[model samples]
Target: MSRLLSKLSGGQPVASAPVSVDAHSLDPQRSAEMLAGFEAADIGWFWESDAAGRLTYLTDSAIAAIGAERDALIGSELTQFLATGDSDDLDSTSRPLKFRLASRSPISRLNVTVQTSQSKEIWWEISATPRRDANGEFAGFHGTARDITKSLAQSRDSERAAQFDSLTGLANRLRMARKLDQTLTAFKKSKRSCAIMLLDLDRFKKVNDTLGHPAGDELLKQVATRIKKLLGDHGEIGRLGGDEFQILLPDMDDRGDLGDLSKRLVQMLSQPYSVEGSRAIIGCSIGIAVAPYDGIESSELVKAADLALYAAKDAGRGTYRFYSSELSQNADWRQRIEDDLRDALTQQQFLIQYQPIVDAKTHKIASLEALLRWEHPERGRVSPADFIPVAEELGIINKIGEWVLEEVCTQLSKCPPEVRAAVNVSPIQFASEDFYDTVDAILNKTGVDPARVELEITESVFVGDLERTLKLFKKLKKRGVRLSLDDFGTGYSSLSYLRDAPFDKIKIDQSFVRGCSADDNNNSALVSAIVSMARALKMETVAEGIETKDELAMVKGHGATHLQGYLFSGPISIDELLDRFDSKELEFKPRGPEKYRAERRTEFRKIGVIHGDSRYNVFLRNLSKTGARIEGLLDVPVGTDLVLDLGDGQLAVATVRRSEGFSQGVEFETKLISDGDRGLCTRHRVSPYQIEAAGRPLGALTNSAVAAYTTGSQSVPRAFVEVDMNAYNRR
Candidate 1:
C-alpha cells in the first residue's frame, strides 16, 4: 500500500511545501501574466535553453519580430528561426552553448538579417544576454529582436535622394560634378581619355513663354527620360538647370564614341513630345570637351565644354562642336569685345553717317538713312554685325539705340528741310520700357516733325513678344512717323510679319540688290517678287546696295519706289554734305491739289517782279478797292495760302480758282500778307541777302538770318554753330 501511494504521488507530481509568506509571492500564472505585461509594453522578452539550444520562452514582440507563433518558437531551436549557421554547437552536458553570443550588458545591439517562419526576410538589431540561475551559473540566454527593415529602407532612400534631382528623379548637377571628378581621376590613373558634353536646348525660352511654365516642366521631364533612355547605362546625365544638361563619358576612347553619342542624343531629343496634348519638338546643341586633351581638371573640362556649347549656339544652333584652343581664344575675344561695347555705349564713341535715299521718279535725294558708325579709339571702325549682336545680348542696345535716335534727330533739325532721315533700331531697343515715351522726348528736344523721322527694324524684331510688339506698333503708328523693315529677306523673314506688322517701307536686303543686275532666274525672280509684294501691300520698297546704273535700272524695272546705295551717294559726313548742296531753294511746298490756287496767286504777284520763263507767265487783271484780281496761266488750287507782295508797302493773301495748272483768273486769299518794299526776288532766283534784307520768306527756314548764315552767304556769328566753318566763311 505504501509503494502504491508513493508511485501515485510521484505520478501526480509532488506538491512543494507551501512556503508562501508574503502576499506578493507570485504564482506561475502570475509570473506568466507579468511576462505578458512586458510583451504588451513593446519590450521583447525571450529565453533560450542550454540543453537544446532552443528558445523556451518568447514574448509577443519577440514572436512578432521572429514572425512565428509562440507555440512554434517555444521548444524549437533558435537557429531555425535565425539566419543559417547562427546556432552554437551543443553537447549532452547542460552547459551554455559555445557561440558568438552577444554580452548581456543591459540593452545591446547586433546587426543581422533574420528570416521568419513564413520565409519573410527582414533586417534586425538584436540585443541578447546570458540568463543565470540563483548561483550565477550560465543557464541559458534571453534577447530582444528589433525589426530594422524600415530604418534600412529609409537610409537607402536617403542615399538615393542625395544623388538624384528632386524635380525629375534624374541625376543632378552635384552628382554630375562628383561623377566627372571620379572619371577624371580614373582617366589619370588608367591613361585613358573621356569626354564631357554640355547640352543646351534650342529656343527653349520660347517654349517656356508660349506654353507656360507647367508645360515647360513637363517637357523637361520628358526630355530627361528620353536622354536617360538614350544613355542607357553607357554614360551619366545630369540636369544643370533651365534646359541645360551635362553628360559624362567615363571611358570613351575613340572620338567617334562622342560623335555617335551626341548624334543619338540630338536625334532622341528632336523627337516630338506631347505636353498637355501639344506636340513639340526640342533639339539640343551639344558641346564636347575631351579629357586629357581639351582639359585635365573637371572644372576646366566643364568650362571648355560650355565654350563649345556657346560655339554650337553661335554656329546657328541644333549642332555639335568640339572644344579647341582656337575656340577658347575666340570666346575670350568675344567676351572682351562685349565688355568694350558696353563701355563704348557709355563713352560716346559711336557716331552716325547719313546715306542718301534717292527718289525713283525725280532722282533727287529726298531722305537720308542714318547709319551707325562705331568710331572706336583703338579699333577704328567695327562692323555693325560684330558689335550690334553683342550690344543686343548685353541689353545695352536700348541705351545705344536711344542715343542714336536723339543724335540723329538733332542732326536732322540742322539739315536741309527737304531731307528726311531714318534711324535703325534693334529688337531689344524696340522692346524697351517706355519706348514711345523715349521717342517723344527725343522729338521734343530736337524739334523734328514726326513725318520727317522714320524708324527701321530688322526682320528679327518682329519675332519676339507678339503682344508687346503689336501694342508698340499701334502706339507708334498713331504718332504719324514711318516704320520700315530693314534687311527684309534675312532672318525669320516670314510673310506673316510683313502682313501683320505695321511697316511703311521694305528695304530689300543688300544681297538681293547686289544681284539685281544679274539675269539669273532665281535672282531676278526674288527681287521681282519682293517688289510686287510690296506694291500689292501698299508698302514702298527701297532697293539697297545699288552700286551701278544697271543695278539702279534693274531695281526700277522691278518696281522699287525708292533706292539707297552708292549709285546715289555713299554715306557722307555733315561737312561733305554741306559741300554737295548747290544754290537751291528748299521749300516746304504742300503737294495737295487744294493748295494750288494760293500758289498761283503768289506766282501772279511775283510775275514781273520775278521773271524767269514765259512758261511761268502771270497777269494781274483788275486792281480792286480792297483786293486785286490776279489772272495767271498758272493752275493753282483754290485753298492755297499765298503770301503776295503788292507794290508800295502793301501785301495780300489769295486763293485761286485755276489752281490745277497754268490757266486764267484766281481770287485773293486775304488782305494780310508780308509787305513793305518786299517784292518777290527772281532773275537771280532768290539771294540770301535780299531775302534777309527784306525779311521775306526764307521758305523751309523759319529764321532768315540763321538760314543765310547756314547757307554760307551771311557772315553772321552764332555761339551754337561749329566755330571752324564760321571762321572760314568770315574770311
Candidate 2:
C-alpha cells in the first residue's frame, strides 16, 4: 500500500483526482482503505504475480478490464496483455517488464500501451517491487497500474506536430533532412541506391498575386493531394516550404525509370486545380539526382538536385532535368546567355527565320512560321529554344514578342497578298493586359491585313484565367485575325479546350510526329484521332516535324490538311524567303531522311580516341547511343577494340565496325544515356574517392585526369597509326 502512494503522486496525472496525502507513514489499515477507494473509483487497477510471473491476485475492476474470467487469467502470464505485439522498438528502448520480474528487480514508472481481447486501447503506467517468502526466497510481486493514456497521446501529438507541416500534413524540412541522412548512411554500406527529386510550382507567385493568399493555400493543398495520389507508396514526399517539394525514392538507380517518373510528376503537377470556386492552372519543373552517382551524402545530393532544378527552370518550366557533372560547368554559361539575351534586346540583334507550312495534298505553300533567332556576332546564330525562357524571366519577352509581330507584319506587307505569316506568341506576352493593344498597334503601323497575320498559341496559354483567355481570343478574332493552336497534345491539353477555343488550326507537336509511323506504338493512332477531331471542329490539322517520308505519308493518309517539317524545308532568312516568293516557286517536294533513326545524331566535335595504351585526339564526325564515327586512327582492323573518352566522365568501350583510311566506325559495348540536355553520357562514372586512395586529394571527376581511374591502362606500344585531325583538316 505504501508503494502505491509513492506512484499515485509520483507526478503522474490521476484518472479522477489527485492524492496529495503522503501515506508512507500512515497506519496499514488507512493505506488499505485508500487503495480500496482507488479501485472502487476505477482510477487504476492493482495486480500481483507469483514467482513464476503468473498473475495471482487482481481486483474486480482489473479483472473486468482484462475481458476474461478470473480463473482463466489467474494463472496467465502478466506480459500477455502488455501490448508488446503492438510495438517492435519498445524492447530496445527499455527493459521488458517481464524480464525485471524474473530478476526480482523493482520497476518505477514504466508506461506501456495494451489491447484487451475486446480490442480496447489502454495506456498504463505501472510500478512494482518484488517480494520475498519467509525463507528469504523469491515468492511473488505487486504493482500499481494507472491510466495515463490521455497524457501520453498529448505528448506524442506535440512531438509529431513539430516534425510535420501544419498546412500540408507532410514532413517538414528538418524531418526530411534527418530521413535523407539516415537512409543514405544505411544504404551506402549496403551498396544500394536512392533517387531524390526537388521541384516547385512554376509561376506560383503569379497565383498568389492574382488570387488571394487563401486561394494559394488551397491550391497548395490540392497539389499535395495530387502528388500523394500519384506517388502512392512508391516514395516519401515532403513539403519543404512554400511551393517547393521533395521526394525520396528508395532502391531507384535506373535513370530511365527516374526520367519517366520525373516526367509524370511534372505533368501531373501542372494540371489545373480548383481554388475557391475558380480554376487555377500552374506548371512545375523537377530536378532529379541519384545516390552514389550524383553524391553519396545528403547535402551533396541536395545541392546537385538544386542546380539541376535551376537548369530545368532556365530551360523553360514544365520540364525535368537529371543532374550531370556538366551542369556545374554550365552555370556561368547560363548566366552569360541571360546577359546576351538582354544585350540582344537592347541592341536589336534578333532576327526572324521562316519555315514554310505546305498543303498536304497540293504540296503548295500554305503559310510560313516566323522563327525568332538571336544572331550573336561571336556565337553565330543563338537558338531561341535556349534563350526564350530567359527572356520571359527577364520580363523582356513581351517586348520581343511585340517586335516579332511588327517585323512579321512589315515583311508580309511587302509580300504578295496570298503569302501569309504565322507568328509564335509567348505565354507571358499573351497574358499581359496590354497584349491586345500591342497587336492592334502593330497591325496599324504595318498596314497589313489582319487575315494575313496568324497568331500561333500553345496549349500553355490555357493556364491563365480561362474566362480571360476566352475573352482575349474572341477579342483578337473580332479584329479579323486567325488563331492557330500550336504544339497540340502537349502541355495541359484537354478536350474541353477545343470546345470553346476559337482556333482555325491545330498543329500536332513534333514529338508525336517523330516516330508516329516507325514504331507499333500509339503515336500513329493519336495523330489520326487528333486529325479527326480537328476535321470535326472545322479546323485544319498541320502535322509538325514530319522529318521523314513515312511520317509524312502516315499523317497525310490520316487526313491531315497541312504538313510542316524539315522534310519540306528548314527555316530560311527573310531575304531567302522573298527570293523564293519572287521566283514564284511555292510548291515544295519530299526531302529529308527516308525514315526516323532515334539513336543516330550527326555531331562534329573533338573527342579522345584510345587504342591499346595510347590515347589520341580524333574528330567525332557522328555520334549515337550505340556507335560513333572517328577520323584520326589509320590501319586499325575492323575488329579492334578501342575506348572513346567522350569527356565529362563518359567513357565508352567500342570495337571497330568499319575502317577505311583515316575514318572508322565503332560500335559501343553499352548504350549511352541522355545527359538531360539532348547529349550523351555514361550511366556511371569513376569514383574520385578511388583516385584519392591512389594518393590524390578527393574532388569531382575530370575526364582527362581520371582516365587511369576508369580504364586502368598503362603506357604500351602504340598498335595503330595516329592522325591529328585538326592538321589533317588543312589538307
Candidate 3:
C-alpha cells in the first residue's frame, strides 16, 4: 500500500518497501498483484482536503459515473456541486434533525438528494460516523452512502397506503390519531379546547344480516365517503372499528361545539346510503367528550365518549349524548336496576294503584285510572317516570301493562255498581296481537262493563304508524270499551284522532295545567286555545295535575270539564276510597271541587235506532225515556250511520252509538239533520214531558216520532223497549 500510494501521488515513500521482505528476497511483483486485487473490488475511495470538502481520490468507476477525473473533483468543493438555491446549512442541519438518539421520539426517516462534482444529483442513504486518528481527536466523518432512490420511491408508496383508508381514501385511524395528538397538543398550547366524538351505527347488524356482508361493506365505504366530504378538513374522521367511527374537532371549545357537531353528524348520517343500486339508511348516535373538559387524556376522553354512547343507546338509538359524570353514574345505576327489574318481574313485586275518575256532574267515582307502582323492597318507591321506560326497553312493559289491565278489571268488578276503571296501555302493548284477546278475557272473566272500562294511551303511540294504530283503536272501540288519549298535547302536535277513531276523551298533559297556574309562565290564552282545539274536535278534556285553587279555577275557566291531580287525590287505597265514597266525605278535595258538579249540564237525550238486515230506521228517543232497549238482526258496526226511511223516503242520519252483537243503539246527528228536522228535534228536546198513562207497559213507549216507511209492514217490536239490553247484560 505504501509503494502504491507513493507511485500514485508521485511522492517519496516513507518506508523502504519493507526491508525485511527485501533482505529475504521479497517480490515487488507479488505486492503489485495483491494491490491490484484490492483495487479490483472497485469499492469507492476518497480523500478529503482540510481547506475544502473536495474528493482527492476518485476510483475509476466513481470518476466514470460522475463524468469527472480525480483532479477535477480535488480542486472543486462538494458544496460547489450542490443544486442552486439549495441551502448547505439546511442540508447539513436536516441530516441530524432526522433522528434523535432516543427511540421514544417520533422517527423522522427521510430520503434526500445531493449533487456530485459533475453537477448531477443523486439520492443516498447517508449514515455517517466520525473517522478518528490515533489520538482520538476531531476528524472528518466517513459514511456508508448507498444509492437508495428506488427503495425510497417504494417506501413513499407504502407510506401513502398506510396513512389512508383504502375504501374511503381518507386518513386511516393510525394517521387520524397521530394528527389528533398533534392538534390537541397545539390547541392546549394556545389555551383552547376541542371535542372527540364516537359514532356508532344503530341496527347495523340488521343491515349485514339482511343485506349480506358485501352490501354491508359497500354501505360502510359509501358512508365513509359521505362523512369525509361532509366534514372536510374542519375535523379528522376515521373508522375506528366495525360500524364505529371517531371524529376529532380541534377548533371546538364548549358543549355547544359538541352539540353542533353531534347534530351535524347525525344529520349527515341520517340520509340513505346507496350501494349497488340499493339504498339503506344508516343512523348514527354520537357520544361526545370534549378535551380539557370531559378529560385531558386520550384514553379517558374515549371512555367518557363510550359512556355517553351507551346513554344514547339506552335512551333509544339514533340520538346523541354529551359526556357527563351523571351519565356514568346513571349507566351504573341502570345496569343494577335492569337486573333488579328482571328479578322483580319474576317475583311479582309490582302493584297497581287505582286513581278514581269522578264524574264532574255526578261527584261520584265514575271510573278508576289504574297506575302502576313499583314496590321496590329496598328502594321504597320509584316513579313510573324512572322505571316504566326501563321496563319498556327491557321488553317487560307488555307483562306489566297486562297485569295492570287485568288487575284493574278484577278490582272494578268488586267495586260499587257505577264505578268504572281505566288502565294506561304502553305503545308496546298496543302493538301486541294478543292485546285485544287479553283485554276481552279480563272484561269477561271479571264481568265488568266494557262500556265502563277505558284504556288510555299516550299520543306518541298514535304518531307512529297512524293507519296501523287506527285499526287497533277501532278494534278496541268495537268491543264496547272506551278509549282515551293520555297526555294529549305534550307530544306529537295534536292530531285529529277523535274524528278518525272513537276516542271518548282527551287528557291534557300536566305541563299545560301546571303552566296555567300563577307561578307558571304559560299564558292563560294558550290554555284557552288548547281547550278550544279540544272542543272543536268534539272530545272531552280532562286536565291532569291541577294543584292550587288558582290552577283549578284556571282549568275550569278554560273549559276543562274533568280534573285530576294531587289536588283531587294522591291515589288513595281502594278501601280508603270506598270509605270516603260510602260516607260521602271529601278528605282530599279541592276548594272549588264542589263547583264542578253544579256547573255540568244535564240536558241528556236518549238516541234510538230501528233497523232490519237490509233497510234501517233511526229515531231520537226522548231524554225522559229511561226504558230504552234495542233488538234485531242488524249487523251495523258501532260508528256506521243508520238512515231511517220515513214515508217520503227521506234520509234522517243517525250514528250507531253502541252495539250488542246483532242489535245496535244509535244517536241522532243533530247538527247533521235538515233545517226542518233540526227545528222539530230542537222543539221536542225542550218540550216538558211526562210518561203517558196508557194501557201499555209502564216503561214501554213507541217513541219513534215519525213513522218509517218499509216495503213490507213489519211491526217494530215495542215489547222489547223495557228489557234494557245494557241492564240485562249486567245481570
Question: Which of the two candidates, 2 or 3, achieves a greater lDDT against the reference?
Answer: 2
List model 2 lDDT by residue over 1-731, tens digit each: 34444343343323323344455566556656776687788876776778888877766777676577888777888788564323432445567666666677777767776646776667777777676666978777666677777787787678678888889988889889989999988987776778899987987877786778998898889899989999999988899999999999998867777777878888888877888887777899988887766787898999989989988887767888888777887787778888788778678789889999999998889899999988898878777777888788789899899989999999898777997899999988998999999999999988999999999998877764778899999999999899999989876788887999999999999878888986667899999999999999999998998889988989999999999998999999889878878898889998887877765778788888776567777889988888999898887899999888887556789999999999999999988877555566666655555665777664545665566554435556667777877786788
User: Candidate 2, which segments miss by more than 4 Å at Cα?
Assistant: 1-47, 57-72, 84-92, 95-108, 134-136, 203-218, 270-281, 604-619, 643-653, 673-677, 682-706, 713-718, 729-731
Candidate 3 or 1, higher lDDT: 1
TM-score per candidate: 0.47, 0.88, 0.49
Model 1 alpha-carbon miss at residue 604, Å? 69
Question: Which 10-residue span in candidate 1 carries the lowest summed lDDT?
Answer: 675-684
Please list the C-alpha lDDT of all candidates, in the order they appear. 0.62, 0.81, 0.58
Model 1 misplacement above 4 A = 1-171, 178-237, 247-293, 308-347, 354-369, 382-395, 413-421, 458-465, 486-497, 506-536, 540-731
- For candidate 1, give the lDDT of residue 37: 54
Scored by TM-score, the top model is 2
Deviation (Å) of 551 in candidate 1: 10
Model 1 Cα lDDT, one tens digit per residue, 563-635: 7876667788865665566444222121222110111123223332111111122455444323445444344
Q: Pick the candidate with the highest lDDT.
A: 2
Off by over 4 Å in 3: 1-186, 196-288, 309-322, 356-366, 463-465, 494-499, 517-525, 586-588, 591-731
Candidate 3, poorest ten consecutive residues by summed lDDT: 674-683
In model 2, which residue pairs have backbone atoms overlapping below 3 Å? none
